[model samples]
Target chain A: MPKKADNSGSAGSEETLLDAAGVKRAMDHLCREIAGALPGDCPVAIIGLRSRGDELAARLIERLAEGGRGDLLHGTLDITLYRDDVSKRMIQPQVRATVIDFDLDDACVVLVDDVLHTGRTIRAAMDALMDYGRPAAVRLAVLVDRGGREMPICPDFVGKTLKLSPSDSRRVYLDLAETDGADRVYLK
Target chain B: MADKTTTTAVRRRSGRSSGFVWGRKHLLGLEDLEPAELLHVLDTAAGFKSVSTRSIKKVPALRGKVVVNLFFEDSTRTRTSFTLSAQRLSADVIDFTGKSSSVNKGETLVDTARNIEAMGVDIMVLRHAAAGAPHLLARKVGCSVVNAGDGAHEHPTQGLLDLFTIREIKKKVEGLTVAIVGDIAHSRVARSNIFALRKLGARIILVGPRTLVPDQMRQLGAEISHDLDAVLPACDVVNMLRIQFERLQSAAFPSVEEYSRLFGLHAERLRLARPDLLVLHPGPINRGLELDSAVADGPHSGILRQVTNGLAVRMAVLYLVHQAALAVNGK
Candidate 1:
């Protein structure tokens, strides 16, 4: 099956990229792509990069279960101590737990996130993951791929490639079912 | 020197609002911190302790940040611990001692700090001979300042690390009878510990010679004790402070011989204390002076654990302050 075009509806300056239903569809599609792309089923893992990334990974796991591939393990990488820009950032980031119960050795890993921006977060997540063990292969899976590349990295599996103006507030507001009472994605 | 328009940005709470907000810009002393703020640092430290147990010990929370360890005095343990903490957080660290820096070439502390900050330094880990040196630099520089050890005033991180180590072993700080033994007058660690223990609802006994353990410290809320054996049986944890004989030249005690005979913590003295009593020391121990050689290496000694916990504690301090500064001046 070929990769379909990004189904982002045309909104000039700033718009809602994905609502609750849109997010579920994009997530279901991405999970299928990830399940197919990853080789072997024994040592497969899905890692979400803290906060909303973990939520996305949970949904991805649910989708994988529905597709009859439920053995894939999942974890979260809290890159509070691993960030490269601590001195330059405006706020002191918290060090969340990097909860990987399964081994990373020779595993086919899919690193998940809600939105992809400067690629620094993924970069940090990669550095942290390698510290655990050498994975056989690592893939980047993101729901929203906002193309403003600061580092030479891109998502291996992207849900929607939404381009925005330079001045478009590059913030993705996501509410998870785990914390907030609803599931939604907003770009403001 | 006062030409730079530096704003006095006190350390605020970091983002994500964990158990509590660590609201203090410069970690100069534990005396100024609320019990809740002190607990926040220790709790934050608890989170980082797991990182060291991992196969990969580095964290990227401070990747792009720069931490400069500015030491005016010579120290190996505190300096190395601070360096490792910064490195573990994935932050760029620069070790700047007074001997190597332009301060020897007549450059003032404020000037030296401004010069470093000019080069995009974010946090300053300072250890100075003069008291309140970090406080002076904190006001002058925009970067977050952490006093690794400032004269005889306070080694705040050391105090917090001690608390963490004690809690790790005893599981509580409240209602514990902690006797701090050794040079109370010239020891910053003693002052820091005294204040921290008082805040966490622990009963502290200041144990040393009358010259070292003055009654004035009683104002700090610690019980002034001249006799160690008298307070030994009632104590839960005994923190033996390092004897800074080099820093004190007035012959506070009659001799090294007399000091050891009077207050030296040996196996015999340890027997007088509670069976489950914990012994602690902030390193560079004088073998037979402050403590017996047996007790220094004894099972009750939390000395080694204190050293190990210092790394995580320092990491937590560096991370919390770095994050707090960022919350104030968003990236």
Candidate 2:
């Protein structure tokens, strides 16, 4: 659960936006929304961006299996080499393994991620995915959509819409039990 | 040299969680790199290894960046590896050999490199007959410089590919006894391997004849051995550096027959080695002289994998140097 986050060293600098129970509810709703919107007869691939997005994809796959849709092709994409800001950054980004084993031909691939902010990541993810194979259609699913999109892109499904202003100094972070110690969303 | 001071990066690991960032605009040699820097390149190479497996087999990491292969000497393998690596990373590559370039018309090496850099080249992969040509060019040019190979000094990517192959197969580099057999006195590959492997915590045994294997190599933290048979039993990995006859001015050993009998790794000598000994050769193999065709093609051989890993390692090096150059320019 989001247990009174105080790790930011101030009394009210960090707040637990969503608890564990709330995260579970949002995930269930997201799965239902995605299942209802997905085409019935087409092959679907659940692809995740690496670091946090891939873990969120795995959880999505598990939830889809629970709902009896267990036949989705899944993979993880590492877009380190596709970033536009690589030369602008001081440190070289560590490249992770991209493990898309299945063919992407004529399949509807859903790109999943934890947070959607600047939209450049989705653009990079799309570029990386296309290099693998030509999918019939590509959709996007994000858990949190704090809208500050620099690119003209939109997510097909979103778990939470915090609507945080793009220019605001505050930030939102997702802590999954797989990577972090708990399942919660915190605002800092 | 002014280039030495400008390009010599501080050899300390960064305190970042994922590890230190590569800060050098040029990859001159591995001799000055810290252990963490070596592992960082290896780890980055591990990530790039998958790009070759994909159907597309390309990444846009170096898109819009230009890499010029500036060679003052003749080479087939290293030049092609760098060329393909730059292509695979989506960088535009220009190949310049000494015969076709203006250097044959008495243009100085620095002038040639500076003229190329003026043509929008972002990085220069240099191979020269002089010992420190890349360092000299790095001092003269504004673009990043990568030493492909320099006279008896170092071939850093070859060293990195060997380290990558060993780590991929043996799963670790520390505590392994690596016997680098043949031509330690003149092999740039051997020198680079010793510098890189020593930094990565591997015990090195430089194996060759007493004439070819210099006692001065021991100062580099390697055990000097004249007998390959004795070194084979304890070595977990054996890298057969090509006997560089072109680099030899006088008779280093008596004859090819005597040298092969004493140091050549064949089935007969392979039997004396550990059953799981990993074999490596940095290409242009001297078929029967350095290793038998069977041993070079045998199950214990990682020679082909070394070539494959060479592409990834070169990609990592190019990507890193380009990133450093951009950072240095505040781009």
Candidate 3:
């Protein structure tokens, strides 16, 4: 998932990278890839990062259920309190509730997010998830993976790999119908 | 400060906007907080309410932060609630009391705070017998300051927890009449609650003998009443403040027994109130005086829940102030 505001500004040249149909195809492909990788009949905890990430996770759960994996656990992780750069930001992100009702112990946890850029959010999410309980395995899934990594972390599942400028001045946004009222991927 | 401007620009450029930005490094009182700010603290506390129920019961939000409890006044619940709240957020807590500390030797409050901050303390929760003690320290110290209680001034966290408990039990604060009964003039809790509840659109009735709750308190936008039973029927919530014998300069009332008979919330008085009237007490209660044992422990009581919510409110305050301080200092 791209770091939010990684290249924040008026889109230098705003363009739609993926429309609704393209988003659907990417999601379907990503779902199949995730289903094929997980062990059959294993109860996977489909946890999403807060804000748009949780929206994506909910959609992912519904998609997985349609594929006959109805035993997946749903959870939402709020990484606002876990971010390493809390003091560096001007406006403090609203700290929302992290609703993980089911036990994470020995369960397969799939962490979901919309964009992966600096990998800091995923780092924070992992730290937060570990506080609840240790899982049998934890995997990362994202809708968009734009280049530029500050941490040595990689995602196990990715919907689209976008190649933007290495200068980090371009923004990547994945808007879903659940949150933004439209499914579209755009570059700014 | 320069970093904030640049980062704020960056944040705006990123196309993400948060409606509220907590800008204060210290929470001295509820008197100055806007309605939205009051709701922000309550909402944040609501988010933290679930953290205490977890198996680990700890979060790394303040993992490396240090919080000092500097109490110039005696308190068991507020002090312990703050300590536990800091610990639950994984912050290192140092408890400094007025009796055992250098303040006993006539060391000024500023000197004590500066010395503690020199040791890299991130936040200081202060309780003093003097009003504006925390405010004075807030000006002198670079670290964040939280007012646990100050003489007849405001216990912001206590006010917040009361609001939290009210909102929890009643599902809202607006359009509800809350009667804050007993020791209003000498009660920092009553002062804080009046500011908070009034800001959130809840009508307030300050009930006590005229001596303890003066007529001048009406300027704070609360109806003053000497009759508890008269006010009880209209109140959706009743907060019973402890009768501070230590704070009284002279006899404000005739006697404890007389005051109990007139204003005490026993079974008889309780029956006069609404069936679902939420009862709250900032504890170390004069058990039979302000509240009876039955009512304090009864079904309508949010007394225990207030204590539980106290921790969450304090945690939210500490975490917010620490973040504000860090954002300002960029450390």
Candidate 4:
């Protein structure tokens, strides 16, 4: 079946990309997909891939709580040290803290990132997460799936799927009302 | 004449980048170091280790340079060692205790570092309660930053001295089993030791309370154990970390008595270790909690050697950093 168009309504017309109702619907669908993949009520965790992913994870938690699963462990991951390209980069990278509140042993983890592109960021996130604790299983989730995967990686739950030309780019601008106030994304 | 020849010789000796040419920047963590660079630091430290034994005990390597010791956390051993090391290298030292500084009067860390930088300080040795504080300050200030100890993050120089002490005793770091015992979670020393020891080819075993030894340690290639006895006999070097009572306010362990019974390295347990096993502690050792005094003062203990080597290691760091800065500036 073809994926549905994001008639989630026009994004720019709403003053911000995602409105409260649109965010709730997207989160609800995401939680359902995540719930279906996870084993029966085993203490699952949501490890957001820093910055925006962290905010998305918090929203997912709230959505899960409203749906009667309030026990999901939440954490944020910083993958600066684990990035393979750190040494080659000219600018000094910014490093944020990795905060995992619960032990990862035997826990199912939903690794969330804002977008899925080259898959390198997710790969770095995985490496960083391993430095904390070993999880039983880790499933990937993303708000937007803009295809350009250099590696074999697929998000289990995706909010929107957009195909872009090799030279062009698709950016997700999340605002404070929904995600965070930071207007960050890719350029062509 | 003789003085001109001596000056040329001194210039050649100082100018030639031996194994000691680290980058012209602050060393906040070993994570930023390459294997060659790490080895360079150690080899240079070995040279300084010899210089520490001389009667005059001073070098002009860092002459006319200014180093500031800005300690936000109270420490006698780390501060004093750095101060003496800077002075021995002929660098002017400015010592600032956090309690007496404007930090007590609500001055921010960056402001304090900037103030010190404005004084024409070339290096700032900082110890703070926040992890990555030195790294933050190092980016803002013009001077090079040397982390004394940041909150459960890293004490790079301590780690360097520990490695130096181990290499001195064991001859080589490869194929040795090293057990770091006690408060692993709250120890910047443990964090740095893990990096340095692992890089130099020592297998690490982290023995502590379940709360103190995070489950994630295994990912760092360390074997984690709650039972000290299980790891003692196999270790070639037993590094006892200080038990921080301050962190205990969070109830990381059940009780001090219980901790002593479970984790403390008494003389009996020390005997259980390999006969050639060396004991090490980043001191201010707790008498009965993490270690027994008898075992600490025992023949196998290298506690005092760590202190002595600390000065030499720091001297080597100052010397190398100064040289690297000079090289970068084309001086």
Which 10-residue window of candidate 3 chain B scores lowest in summed lDDT? B9-18
Q: Per-residue alpha-carbon lDDT of model 3 for B223-327, expressed as tens digits?
A: 998988788999999999889888899999999999999989998888888889999998888999888999989998999999999988998999889878876
DockQ class, candidate 4: incorrect
Better of 1 and 2 by DockQ: 2
TM-score-best of 1 and 2:
2
The candidate that wins on TM-score is 3
Would you estimate the TM-scores of all the predictions? 0.75, 0.92, 0.93, 0.60
Model 1: residues with Cα > 4 Å off, grouped in runs: A1-49, A52-76, A82-91, A99-103, A110-123, A139-188, B1-16, B19-23, B100-107, B115-120, B327-331
Here the TM-score of candidate 3's chain B is 0.95
lDDT of 3 by residue, A1-188 (tens): 23545445553456788999988888887898898887765668999887778888898888888988888899998877788876654567777789999988989999998889989989999988988998999999998889688898899999888887776555577777765788999876
Reported per model, the fraction of native interface contacts reproduced equals 0.39, 0.46, 0.46, 0.00
* Candidate 4 per-residue C-alpha lDDT over A1-188 given as tens digits, one digit per residue, 9 for 90 to 100: 12323442332222234455665556667778876666665789988876568888887888777777778899887654345543332212333346776788888999998767889889878865665667888899987677878778888898766556554322343433443333333321
Give me the displacement of residue B21 in model 3, in angstroms.
0.5
For the candidates in turn, chain A alone yields TM-scores of 0.86, 0.89, 0.90, 0.78
Q: How many backbone clashes does candidate 2 have?
A: 0
What is the Cα-based lDDT of residue A137 in candidate 1?
91
* Per-residue accuracy of model 4 over B45-154 as CA lDDT, tens digit each: 76565446544465555667899999998899999999999998778999999999999889999998898789788888999999999989977987788888999889
lDDT, candidate 2, at A169:
39
Q: List candidate 4 segments past 4 Å from native.
A: A1-188, B1-20
For model 1, how does the per-residue alpha-carbon lDDT over A50-163 read when each residue is reduced to its tens digit?
A: 767888888888888787777888888777666666555343445556788777898988999878888888887888889888998999999878766678897899876776
lDDT of 2: 0.86
DockQ of all predictions against the true structure, Cα-based: 0.23, 0.33, 0.46, 0.01
